[model samples]
Target: MTAAIELHHVTKRFGRRTAVEDLTLTVPIGEVFGLLGHNGAGKSTAIGMMLGQVWPTAGQVRIHGWDVATQRTRALARVGAIFETPAFYEYLSGLRNLEIFSSYTAPVSQRRLAEVLDWVGLTGREHSAVRTYSHGMRARLALAQALLPHPDLLILDEPGEGLDPEGVHELRQMLQRLHRELGLTLLISSHQLGEMEQLCTRIAVLRQGRKVFEGPWDRVQWAEGPIRLEARPFERAVAGLQAVGLVLEAGRDAEGGWVRPAPGITPDQLARWIVEAGFDLLELRRPRQTLEQFYLSLMRPDPQSDSRSDSREVTRRPAAT
Candidate 1:
């Protein structure tokens, strides 16, 4: 189980400010690993270092076994990336845009451009001028450029930048398909967290230039439940149920506000209690966590606490220029 990507105490500083600090992580092969964070959480800085677009002030980034900074060409051979603005020559046709990128590919690169176009859902629109293509189309074209060299690792930064809902969905499907079928390891980040949940297998949360959380989707440790869970028919033995350590949700629900244990409680215990209570156990799941809710919970601040620590991060917005 060699990691496809590894960062060792990586730090990137700009003048007196550190964009990324003491960062370390591994992205295993064949997994859709997501880099989650706020606008100034150093995601782009880290990513730029990973791609050789920006040099780290300290530490190192490695892809497969190649050191990104020292062995730039070898390390990059396995990576495809889509950074912020997906640049393109609008005057050229979609196919031509791809063709231009394709010229940079080695002749032996696996039908590279064509394969990526189909993978990104631009098969029929390949001949359309870049100007005629929709925003989504342009993004996909940019993706095709990244895919041009048929790299084993794909790094997409805010991949859904200009895509409509439908376009975003298409990219999601494409990533899943590539990960499952082609054995491509995909690492992506986006402000569109809701969409990321549908596609990423594991996610790393970064805040204020440090790693806060990293794990499978289900294993993300949030201090509070994102959605309210309700179980109908409270058991008469409420005291006994509480003894098992499931907290009562403390709010009014049509059924009951008793919160279920996040990962440790068994449904059987509640189910049996419902039977004993002489009522049917109907719904047992919470509402799905929205991107907004999950992100806000992690970035949530202590109102009275000094804001000086992350004042820079909280106020920074994505580049609109």
Candidate 2:
């Protein structure tokens, strides 16, 4: 089956500065893919290229197997997007704004307008002037307009911006419903890592206009967090483990010591070794790495490189069970 979105060797340069470089990605149908980066990481630029609003300086972008640059019409026919801050005539009612925007593409029936408004939780507010709407409400209005097309693919740029905790939760639930019931392919870009952790099945991380990581979250090769060991006769336990060649680090509050086992040694092996050595094993805990930790590791500077450059692309493998 054709992918919902594809970018092969895509690059975008603005004069002397590159906004995106050598980006190659694929979003399969029905996947909730995420684009993640700090400001000026070229996320919006890449979204623009996909929307045919910005031409790529090199390579190609395709939507459902249709080239965006050459086959713009067909490529975007079934796509919807809320790129940047969604704009509308503030003086006009929300329903009027939707009607006008929808008219630019195709005629939308009143029933379809009502359906989308309700989907975004803006049903009653549709008749209110957009200027009277709060930021969160305005965002919902933008989403309602995007849904006017009943797009099979939805590309959202910071859809969570301006939303409070409740609003953000609602947005997440609505997007999930669209993908679940309508089978819409979603490409979301946001700074909300925790929210992304819950929403995206796969993600691509961009830095300095370059894609440094792209894969399922489970595939990210996270730095091994230290294992906390609590044992009786701490000094003997430390000496016994160290004598056996297990690398030990100082532990935090209440922990007897921390163990970073060698490549071949497992945590279970360490526990067994302690018991066999006649030391009482009180507790053994390994803290799992979160998505935030993984992202921070990627963004962390490489000690070997100059200050201007990012660390090397993350090496990925199936995470240990």
Candidate with maximal TM-score: 2
List candidate 1 segments past 4 Å from native: 89-105, 108-112, 121-134, 221-235, 243-255, 259-263, 272-283, 286-288, 303-321
Residues 74-129 of candidate 1 have per-residue lDDT tens digits of 88886788866788888988887777765654443436556777777788888887
Which candidate's lDDT is highest? Answer: 2
Q: Candidate 1 at residue 220, lDDT? A: 42
Clashes of each: 3, 0
lDDT values, one for every candidate: 0.71, 0.82
lDDT of 1: 0.71
Q: What's each prediction's TM-score?
A: 0.77, 0.78
Stretches > 4 Å off in candidate 2: 221-287, 304-321
**In model 1, which range of ten residues has the least summed lDDT?**
312-321
lDDT of 2 at 29: 91
Tell how far residue 185 is off in model 2, in angstroms: 1.3
